[model samples]
Target: MAILTPGKPPRATSRSRSDARTRFSDRASAWLNHPMADIVLVLTASGLLLALGSIMVWSASTVFSYTQFSDAFYFMRRHLVFLGVALVAGWVTSRIPVDRLRGLGWLVFSVAGLLLALTFTPLGYGVGGNNNWLNLGGANSMLRVQPAEFAKLAIVVWGSAVLANKRRLLDQPKHLLVPFLPFSLLLIGLVVLQHDLGTAILLGGLVVAVLWCVGAPLRVLGTLAVLIAGALGTLVLANRSRVDRILGFLNPGSDLTGINHQPMQALYGLATGGWWGVGLGSSRQKWGSLAEAHTDYVLAIIGEELGLVGTLVVLLLFVILGYAGVRIALRSSTFFGRLVAAGVTSWIMMQALVNVMVVLGLLPVLGVPLPLVSYGGSALLANVMALGVLVACARDEPDAKAWLKRRATLRSKAPKRRFSAVLPGRS
Candidate 1:
């Protein structure tokens, strides 16, 4: 028996506490299992990352913009314009019918391939020694595009369509490798010729993901992995700069002022940030200490200014985005949808992992920008459009479709307000 104080309330018993916890857990599980959950999660996570990206881009680019363009907001303004364009594109993509994508996949892939091929023409230009950019308008114009970015999406859509069609025939190696392997190799070879190994690696990963989703045998996958490894090794050995970076990664203390400068500076920025960060825009690294502060090294700036907590938040958002993508893939009714969802999820997550690892000095500099967070018009546009496709897939899930139909019915049956219904003396 327990005695209660005269003026104090009695404490809750363990059984009551346990019951409360059980009820809370039940509610959470139900909410997570709701038909609308995956769609909501994807949209929310993407939105948060976009918002944060805008903020970080503005913060990280202020110094560089002011120095080069004599305007602090130059990059930010450009980023906003790109953001607006991307949002509109994403909205349009989200409305596109999933079934139509299959029919249009080849056309999209062909267009992307054409654009990529044009990168070697007179209109093509090199950036950071990689001839992977196409300059539109005159040479002085700012309207440049990276066809490799769009190629990522093209591969996902086209590869998924082809694999999904050959589902039954996938058991035969010839059927699996005929068209898909040839086309994928062509795109990857184009990217490699431009010396953009990072994009090539990503394209390769997409191929692996598509094949795995279609149930390729482990032995075949193992052979492909070895081939990819050998190719990458050969590519690395072919370039002195690439070899230097590899050596620098292996021996961090060898070249402080050369190949290791950027990595070391990134580490310094992260170290300065400590736990909470040095506070947004207060980063010392952004003040001429860090290169590509708004692009490839933006994560370093994020760590410098926002600290570990901020970095963790960004990571958590990616995790949520990845989780929603997987959920959508699992719930999809068609094999194409599954392959697409899985492909996009792998693309984003793998890119994010690579970027983060590079910034932390765990890997050599790969020039891979942090998706959505980095300041690149082409990348931002491509990523958001891909996300829109993911959302469309989520909506096409059987349960989600039923829920949406029910919602539409309810919305249609609801009473609408008349113009003068609420006005005084109006019935």
Candidate 2:
């Protein structure tokens, strides 16, 4: 309250207030411009989807579990276990350097190729008519692995790494086609050979998406697009089951009790839910009406149980995730990070859209599981890892570097020396 002497220091309270305000303003500006803002959005959206998946998986799988294993929580328990493993893997993967990942592109691609090739051996286990699952367990058959699911992540990481390396040389078709084209084609061919049309389609989509994001010449993208479409069409024609699904899609009135049973039942479940749904654990269709209710068609089960509201919430979460992913890609400074962010985002979003379209009868049943939401170990693990990579990109973004530098400086500052308690040369 009194006037300060001319040579005296300002009041301690006044100095503290001013310092606090300055610090607050600095932090506010930093947060507004920080790369972590986008990453927070990504993690928040992922957490929401994962939490929702846990609840829906439990609800949808209870009936199926009870009949098969005499325990309603069997699938739920297994899914939680997988979820734990995936989250940890994602965190660890996020800590790895993007440069290292870029360097391992070809190696990762080769391993994925090897796994796909192994599907043709005697150790291959065919499920749901697709010889795509690898049998890696003992004679008791305690473990099963899906190589196709892992292939999605591998293609995105490896493919984007290749494209990012040639970012400036992308005008040349040779640069675009060299390793990415050949390796991508081989992997897609292997997945199709295993009778998995859905994964093959996703792989094809992944190539186009990555190349396009990396600014590949239009001529190159167009040529690959046509070739991919032709290959898919040919594969569809060669497979009787896929042809039937296409026919069933074209003619909804055909054979409700035959090849179309699954799709029709899925539709029936959705229609029965109407607005608010039949209530959790009260779905009539899940008892015996709809098969694969816990996997590919879990969205339909959600519609039937939690109604249109729940389904919309799931859709909204995907949209939020996609938006955050795009933002992250845009904010990334490194070519490798930018390419990876786009590639992973496209694969996950495209797969989710495909699953939803199939559930809604807009597309043929491709047997693609809903990412992060459906109950599949390999798919969940791949998705979490992909998101982990996204987090890493966000962490290394231009602004993130600045933030980290500031933090390092703070930690490096030496505390003021206190010698009052020590006598000089006492020892």
Tens digit per residue, CA lDDT, model 2, 234-289: 88899888899899899987998887888888998898898899998778777877
Q: Write down the RMSD of all candidates, one decimal each.
A: 2.0, 9.3
Off by over 4 Å in 2: 1-34, 138-142, 408-427
TM-scores of all candidate predictions against the true structure: 0.95, 0.87
lDDT of 2: 0.87
| Candidate with best TM-score | 1
Per-model lDDT: 0.92, 0.87
